[model samples]
Target: MADTEEMFLRAKHRTFSGLTEGSCPSTRSCGATAERLAERLAERLTEWLTEWLAEQQAERLTERLGERQAEQLTEWLAERLAEWLAERLAEWLTERLAERLAEWLTERLAEPLRDPEEAERQWTGPFCFIQAADPQLGLMKAWRIGDAVGGGDEWEEEVALTKQAVAGVNQLRPRPRFMVLCGDLVHAMPGTEFREAQERDLKEALSGTDPSIPLVFVSGNHDLDQVPTPSTVEQYCRAWGDDYFSFWVGGVLCLVLNSQLYFNGSACPQQKEAQEAWLEAQLSRASSAEPKPKHILVFQHIPLYVKSPDEQDEYFNLPQEARQSLMERFKRAGVTAVFSGHYHRNAGGCQDGLDMVVTSAIGCQLGDDTHGVRLVAVTADAVVHRYFSLEQLGQRGVNEELRKMLQAC
Candidate 1:
């Protein structure tokens, strides 16, 4: 027993050491590899270009100028042309690659909830929708081993949990009008190992969802960069859907926000500004339009404040300044409840009339809360919601409560 314990400790030490001393992390190496490849392409392209220019223009240049002058002009032109070509080629390649990957994600995920125009946005009656977050397809095991990063080489647990959640929602007696995954669709960051596989597997697990229930998505910090860039946002839009959007269900206006912008828009100010403008426009129109919405609900990845609007800023909640401004706007605009998921635990409170409801994760738990999802039932008077473990989601009691809520419409 003593010998076995010693061997296990040594093996664990080696694993930790290997990560620190390992070759370049996949995220960094991916960027470096693209840069180097572009450099080589530019070098080869320069050679080919110079030869072509020299051959094609040599006779004409000699006829017009001295041989020496013509030769110098040709060299100058080749250098300038090569530099321009390289810049354009590199830019094109990055955009194209991100686009193709996004296409791949969309092809598998099959989410069609982006277009608000194609769907119903009118006040109907009362209904229910599932609001869950942080399926984070690879975080369960990683968190267990205390190596959240670089330890997500496998994500079977997340896969099972996601499927379980899907099945739970599907079995509801009164099916949810739609389901929104608040963010962190996968634990693997945008450019790390197992990211693609996790995304693909997640999509496959979600594919079993009933066609009648549309799947809505919100962008999480893990979904893009903690401080996202234009490139990452664009990539996210391509792979998922619009980072922010609006839709109406049973007369309620639902806004899916990209909280990453409000979190850290330093890298992408223009995007942040654009979202702000769009949001104001959305709020203004929704509040004043004919037959005003039954209620305005917001969906985002990070809660405005886990407990109170005056709470100190932390990693789990939005910064105080942004939070105050946005929350006030939401309150003025008649936003009822702001649904979010990032704390990996349930925390939030009603501020004045606004409710900042934070749901626990469906994949991993950072605290005592069991893995679960939030069910939100919308009525003409209020937006009622509850959290239930996956096992409890389909229970008769839960179903009866949901039925009662919808019947109140």
Candidate 2:
């Protein structure tokens, strides 16, 4: 019985030891050395944890980086688009406005006041016109002070005279067709003091004239600057109509010249050349026109000659070379008369079928002639003219002889 019990106990011991050896425990009671077993378990746990953490963190980091990049790119594009739109809009508006203004100014200068296609060139009948000059507004005061170049501050005396002249023109029996003031509209030079005021007062005085009579303005030395540039000439045109223009009344072709151009063209040679070309065309065309003018006349502020065609050059007359050339041109063109008034007195003569009429001033005179205007009669036969003082013309009218001549047409 002892030997059988010993065999069973040995069997039980072997079975139990096999079970403990095969089992793995996480505690220090394991069969292997405790330190080595613990080290191997810790190494396996650390490897698993590191691999799991890497998967989760890498996914989140990729998602966050992608979202931030998209947001920043969207913001950058939006800001660039807004800046470009603002810059383009301003450039477009400024360019369009400048083009429109230039077109308007060009149209206004070409047409001026008259319409030739509307038959203003047609002949109605024989008529008479009044020619006058130098209603120089501030001249009286300037002459009194012995300094006409400086101009005067006051113009009351000349203003009164201009009003009287207008009143006299209104009192005529058969009213004059038009009144031409041959130049020196004011004593003040351009850019001088009292220029605007003098022009204003003179215009106010002449406004009293009858509306039937149009006023023809001629530019004088005072109206043009002493040495005229392109800028000065443009300024003069703006103030007193065109510096030079032509018109017709009762089949008479009247050519008004800017004599200042011929006098001094050093500053504006182009302007001088243009006027010469225009005058040449005008004279050549009028000489052989289809309808034909009753008589061709020339009006200007400065005379080709003050007294005689062959006279020498002076302040009051055109240069001798210009005078001869113009006289030859006028004779060729059948121009019957040339009227002017910078001499401040009546001093001109007729030579070789051309009548040079230099009418006196209506303002301060530099000579012995009284302040007056000229009455010009146009007929199928001949052109006739007579100078009369303001008092004589206003009170007496044209005498019966002159009245008969005007009605003869």
Give the C-alpha miss distance for residue 393 in model 2, angstroms: 1.5
For all candidates in order, the CA lDDT equals: 0.78, 0.73
List of clashing residue pairs for candidate 1: 123-251
Q: Report the lDDT tens digits of candidate 2 across residue range 292-406.
A: 8778898888899987787878888888887888899999999999999888999899989999999999998889988888988888778888888888877774655457776
Q: What's the C-alpha lDDT at position 209 in model 2?
A: 71
**Reference-based lDDT, residue 364, model 2:** 88
Clashes of each: 1, 0
Residue 134 in candidate 2 has what lDDT? 94
Judged by TM-score, which candidate is best? 1
The regions of model 2 sitting more than 4 angstroms off are 1-118, 399-401, 407-409
Question: What's each prediction's TM-score?
Answer: 0.70, 0.70
